[model samples]
Target: MNPAEQAPSYRGASEHYLSPSRRDPVKVLSEEPVTRRVLTEALAALALPDDRPVDVLDIGSGTADGFSLLTRAADGDPAVVEEARLHYVGLDVDPEMVETAGEQVRSPSASFVHGDVRSGIPGGAFDLYLSCGVPYSHLTRDELVGALRSVLTAVAGRGRRAAVVVDVLGRYSVEWQPNWHLDRWDYAMSFFAGGGSGISEPMTFYDAPALTSVLDEAMAGTGATVVSRTAVDRSVLVGRHTATGTFNPGVPRFRTLVNDLLRDPASVDPADLRFTPATGGAPRDVLDWLAGFAARWNAALQPYTGAGPLDRDAAARLAHALLGLERAGGPGLGVGHSFTTTLVVDPA
Candidate 1:
């Protein structure tokens, strides 16, 4: 898929919902201060030889936490605010996100871009690139290579050093399967206008190996070095990223749902594919609900976005049946099986 062209719609809602829902929610719950401390300490431990000011590029930098991290530590941080006037460039796929972040953040040398970080880095070399969430994990190998090429080109030309703090998906993270459709559904209904299927659909993802391998390759191409890295629980993954840990997919039955989702893109409607929370909805067991949603959505959406040869029409028909408010349980899981991957990305 053309990352640039197919980037808008999906990324739009993704940035909005994940920014607040997943990233903003569990800071305290997951002890963000501790994670921030780890970052500061990591920087401090860096063998950066020169006293030259470091220019930092935050890939998937949602809401500009990189700036905040430079100020004071988060919930459990022990690192003193070794503040530096970093030439910060924050990038996100969502144009609205970059706009909102630019308005709220203030820095003499800071800038925000409404461009694809996966398109590679912006002009000018950077010293470090940070990503709290596994944003790189979302890109394909080609885009990954492009992004790395951009980063390396910038720094190498300037004779500067660069490092990337990436979030790595451990083999066991909840909701880490080739099932991104559920997320698309939730993102659309909750953020986008109601929600409807369209031209080209996105591939369902949970590309752990691809993420790690691509990043390793990206870094390898760059003469930049890796100083220190660590990964804690999602209690630390703040702002728009899902909470780290195991979650439950509430649907009792799910195999059929998974198949249908893997088969069609326009099969189900966003509204029908949801889980109610405790205050009366179906369920909010993050893992369970998210997994179930993904399974059903993947089965239905994959046809259109075929990860392989998933029949387009058949998948759409199945999704349609599932999303038919009459077919789905109105506000429940109806009768489909669900899927989930524990959110366990070891950024170590």
Candidate 2:
């Protein structure tokens, strides 16, 4: 799919953020603890000069929220925020987003660019390169590699060690398990409430292995070498784009529980369900219900464990179970809604 066609939705969303009441849900969930954590991880990987302003480039930077998060996270540390100045440059395909970001992210050292990062990254070498909000999910596998290669070459040219953070949609996320078998799926709706141009765009999903392979291939001939990688986030709840028609409207109790869980993951009480819909369990107990459903789900997916693709039905079932449970221990690579990988790139 052409990236330009999908610009309307993002353009509309950028305008929505300008409104006091409206906020992008994906950014809200990711910009805080999630982005901050990854930012810290990525920054810690780089060997940056403390006496100079840290040059940072945010690819697919929508509203420059990640930049803001970085500044806020380092507010207490005078070294990162003050002594080493943060010169942030953000790039986005949507001109409106670029414009809005330029206005909202007003800083002496911040700049916004309207361009496609896959073709070429703007500016000189940056100390940090961030691609959050699952921007890479929109690219084809080949395009992703080419884009990464371009970025790596640019960074390599400067002969500077940099930190690059890549964020993508997880294949094992509960939000889109129904379509996990496909390498790509059409996602509809805006990520914000009362946002989105009511359009669907093709998006790719990835597990840690698949993503790591892409990065390795992209950097094979470049000066950038990934030193470390860590996946984080476990968004067990429904995402804004998937919530519109994710569940059957005929089942109100199940739908209500799912909605509640999405609204606040920690505030939900699974015991409040008035009825047991699909997964057989007592209506008053959530863990029992999750365990039973998980057994069935894992059983269905057992054949695909460390093997081939999961059965669509089985994937959907596992996703449902995970959503109902709202938490789990295991791999964050393929399971998180916004699974992030922070790589400390060593300059060639």
Candidate 3:
């Protein structure tokens, strides 16, 4: 999508975030925790000096959600984070989001500005540059490169070590199996009421190779060298769309069944959670991963199937096993709802 066409509109985004689906068990128990692990690792790598407050720039900072996530991650070590206070600056193109964040995240150390990453990343030399919620997916391939270049340039200019977390839609998510062969598509936020303004917008999806190429191009001659990089997949099977079934209706509602199990094990029928892989245009490796995951996922729920309503203890065990499966699935290969690549850059 062109930069102009990709302008964010949060008309119903707040409402969507407040919806019950947003807090679904899969998200609370699975997605958020996995993402937090990544963020925590990135923060630890920074090893910020205790001299001054850490400056943070959040790209596409929707309602300062990234701020909240970072704060929680830092909260793990209150002495380090509280002593070196976080000075957060969130940038977004949507005015409503900026205003909402300003109102909601009232803090002397935090502020929101109306801007687009494609134009430029403002107020940098930051200790951390964060993007969550697949914000980079809104940009076309070229636009993504430009945005990253801007970030790299800023870090290099300041000649300070920094961390950048790039989150984008995974091209091979089971939620959109039909589009595995394509890098970009019209993605719909179908979890919202009435199918979320009934509009689908063009979004760029990324596999490891494609995203690596973009980052390489962005780093070219930017005077920034990547010290380390880590990539992980979020929501391998229980992505929100898995329950909505808007794109891949043939897939099982793993998200819904998981939520049911989390809320009330007695209300769930284990048979409904069985995963059956379908033939698609995805690469053999991706298909193989899905098949392996499906086998394990099914096995986890097998003992409970037809065992009648599960007791609370049994249900908790199943949930823990499922979450462990997702975490141990290994590095992301675009086989999840969102793929996050964290880069620790040395501005030499």
Candidate with best lDDT = 3
- Residues 106-214 of candidate 2 have per-residue lDDT tens digits of 7787889888876588868788888877888888888888888888887777888888777788765445545555667776644444454544688877876778788
Cα lDDT of model 3 by residue, 136-238, tens digit: 9989999999999999999988978899999999998889888887898898887774333544789999988899999999999899999999999888888
lDDT of 3 at 76: 41
- Model 2 TM-score, 2 decimals: 0.72
Q: Evaluate model 1: give its TM-score.
A: 0.52
lDDT of each: 0.44, 0.62, 0.82
Look at candidate 3 and tell me the lDDT of residue 66.
74
- The residue pairs that clash in candidate 2, if any, are none
Among these predictions, the greatest TM-score belongs to 3
lDDT of 1 by residue, 275-303 (tens): 33222222334345435545654454444
Name the candidate, 1 or 2, with the larger TM-score value. Answer: 2
Instruction: Sort the predicted structures by lDDT, highest score first.
Output: 3, 2, 1
Q: Could you tell me every candidate's TM-score relative to the true structure?
A: 0.52, 0.72, 0.92
Q: Name model 3 segments beyond 4 Å from true.
A: 1-8, 19-21, 73-84, 193-199, 278-280
Candidates by TM-score, descending order: 3, 2, 1
